[model samples]
Target: MKLNLILFFFCTLVTISWAQSPNLSKYNEEIKKIEDTVKYFEVEKINDQFYMLIGGGGNVGVFVSDKNVIMVDNKYEIIEEVLMSSLREITSNPIKYIINTHYHHDHSDGNRAFGKMGVPIISHENAKVRMQKVTQLYGGIYDFIDGFVQDKYPTEALPIITYNSKLTLSEDGEDIEMYNFGSGHTDGDSIIYFKNANIMHTGDAFVRYGYPYVDLNNGGSIKGIIEVLGSIASLANDQTVIMPGHGNLSTKQDVLDLKKSLMNLYQKTVLGLEKGLSYQEIADSIDETLAADPVMPGAELTKLNYIKSIELELNN
Candidate 1:
């Protein structure tokens, strides 16, 4: 009986270890290969409000106010303690609200963590649906969708509040306007604007480096991203700071340059579409005339991926 009990205990430990390996591994690749040597949560001051960039599956925005703390996206469950503790380095105020840019795992996995703190979590109605699927597939512990699915099963981290079109939030004297950026990065991608701070947090909807990934399968569109970015150009200006889905913090001119690149790609693809070119023909053949503009280093892969996504979009 004693031997059986010991074996059971050992097995339980192994199971727990195996279950946790995935969550930790999620950031392993990101942390291991950062060429910029940029640690997560590089702190910066914008209009007196401190903003921290928490880069994981995507980048998260930590907006510190005088009275309350507002978070854009939760990093991951494994890092919830770390992310929160890091926040403590800046302010001890409890996280008042968290907005899910979309339903992707890297952004929403921390929902359970913040939920435990009793903070109200909100997202687009579509974002909630996507997260439910990620939760079921990963068993609620990890974010990788394939190959690790068997090892990283996790529970669904659902959102408490969901908005369809737009939601305006006023908390502790800060004005945050969450606007759906159409079907750019995702069907429910939202642009979180801090009115007082003159900061706009563009989720995966606006990644700074590489060719942007438009998850067309999940209602993303390359053309849509271009249109959305065009609109955001008006929403921002020379003094406005832009928080992207990934990469470093940037400015309105930086965001504008990004839009121009996508627009160039779209115009190329549209011309190909007019010619009735097949997806492969355009993806492999369309000229990247705008590739040199944004000039994000190590984004050669992204350019190809952008071309391929455009081709796929035309086919669809």
Candidate 2:
């Protein structure tokens, strides 16, 4: 009887440990898949010192300095070595800081690799908290039709530095400002602006991808996104270059265009609600021109998901 009791306690402890630890096997498999797609990756020079790495995951903004490099978003894990190689092609400075625009795996999964190298990771406090545990991602047009589970990140992969609304890092005579404009794509989205370079890296907050995705399950709302976009447009000037979370380099005009599109959608959604239209009815009523907007490639489903998000926001 005592032997059985001891075994039971031991098994219980093991179960608890397994629950606490990140799924290393799953993490490794994901890394392997990302590495296999390295051929799609390309690095584009934005200016004298800043470069944009595209393909694989979210766009990465690389700010090369005389002594060190500051990365706005560090794609995936295995992709870090590839990113480092790409940086070496540009400059020999070591990566000194990693700033996560948000806690999404595509944008910040490389945090584990960089964190392991003792590179300090900075993000919004909410992002740090979200990264520390398993997260559910919803509102995708396809793969996330139901929802997707993002496993918890290991301790070393988590952000070491966190801020509430704003934080500034002065490096190489530049004041890099990171600002969280409340909840939009996620509760912790950060829009980073490089003062000297006049370049802004608007994480998932602004994407070139057709139809914006609002992660309602993760404190995201279309209304919030519209508000955030307005703020970003106001902060940007005609000369400012924008490095979107998942697209080619953009300009302030592009930001305004996206903002205008979102605003139009918000107004339409509000009008539909006022008319007592169901979410499906509103989605179906979106005209071809609006649904076929270049930003929303997956027209029908994307419209549905977007309308659903707006409805959820309004009802709440």
Candidate 3:
């Protein structure tokens, strides 16, 4: 009996460790090292109330008021010290609200750190549900799908408040609204708008990165992206400053251009599917002109990944 109990306990420990490894082995070593060497973070002031925190997993939005401060996305856990230091440069008010745009670690990994400091984190209901199931520290294909072991997240890292469609926050004169664009980047993807500032923080749904990854396993689809992008473009005007999940800040026109490119891809995929082409065939027969469009600018591998995601989404 004693021997059996010892074996059981040993196995449990090993299982837990494996479940929470966070796939450090999968990251690019050189890029990770470069990001690590940066001791400070840069903040770009969008206007009087909104600021963008650059150089992390995702672009963080910092909104300041006389009484309180609000944040959108906290990047990674490794970014804690520098993120906090950068926030201090803007204001010393308490961080009243943290809006997590999605469940991806690059955007929400710092939840544990911020939660410990007593800040309330808010996210779409599905984001909270997915975060509860996430075991790894990295949010990628493996974590989004079923390849890796999933360990439960620490209580501190989970979002405390969750909304179904929309939630609005009033900070001084600025009205911050959070809107959920269902099943685009993830089941719980959200887009944040600083109404007074005329700035939109488009989570992973609209990124400046080469090709956006559609988390098909997590209820993401290219069709949903098409709808979401159209809605986003319609909501903006010439003056709206768009803040993407990655890359430099952009304008409304850029978002529209990306939408056009994605629409073209979606049409081509549909056409190929109608002709009964296999995934490989469809990928191989990509419209070269559309693929080379400047709007997307994603690498071949990234585009291929998107193609795979689209195929999976369509088949299912």
Q: Candidate 2 vs candidate 3: which has greater TM-score?
A: 2
TM-score, cand. 1 vs. native: 0.75
What are the lDDT scores of the predictions, listed in order?
A: 0.69, 0.82, 0.77
TM-score of 2: 0.88
Write down the TM-score of every candidate: 0.75, 0.88, 0.84
Number of colliding residue pairs in model 2: 4
Residue 206 lDDT in candidate 3: 89
Best by lDDT: 2
Q: Which candidate leads the pack in TM-score? A: 2
* Candidate 2 minimal-lDDT segment of 10 residues: 288-297
Give the higher-TM-score candidate: 1 or 2: 2
Instruction: Residues 1-316, candidate 2: write the lDDT tens digits.
Output: 9999999999999999988864455445656777886754587997789999888789999998889999998988867778778778888988889999999888998897889999999999999999988877763443343445677779998888999988999998999999999999889999999987899999999988767666777787678888898888888888999998887789988877877877776778789889999877776665642344343355666777677667767788
Estimate the overall C-alpha local distance difference test score of candidate 3: 0.77
Off-target runs (Cα >4 Å) in candidate 2 are 1-32, 140-145, 288-297
Q: Enumerate clash totals for all models, in the order shown.
A: 8, 4, 2
The candidate with the higher lDDT, 1 or 3, is: 3
Question: Which pairs, if any, clash in model 3?
Answer: 22-137, 135-151
Which pairs clash in model 1? 138-152, 138-153, 138-154, 139-153, 139-154, 139-155, 140-154, 140-155
The C-alpha RMSD of each candidate to the native structure, in angstroms, is: 7.0, 3.0, 4.0
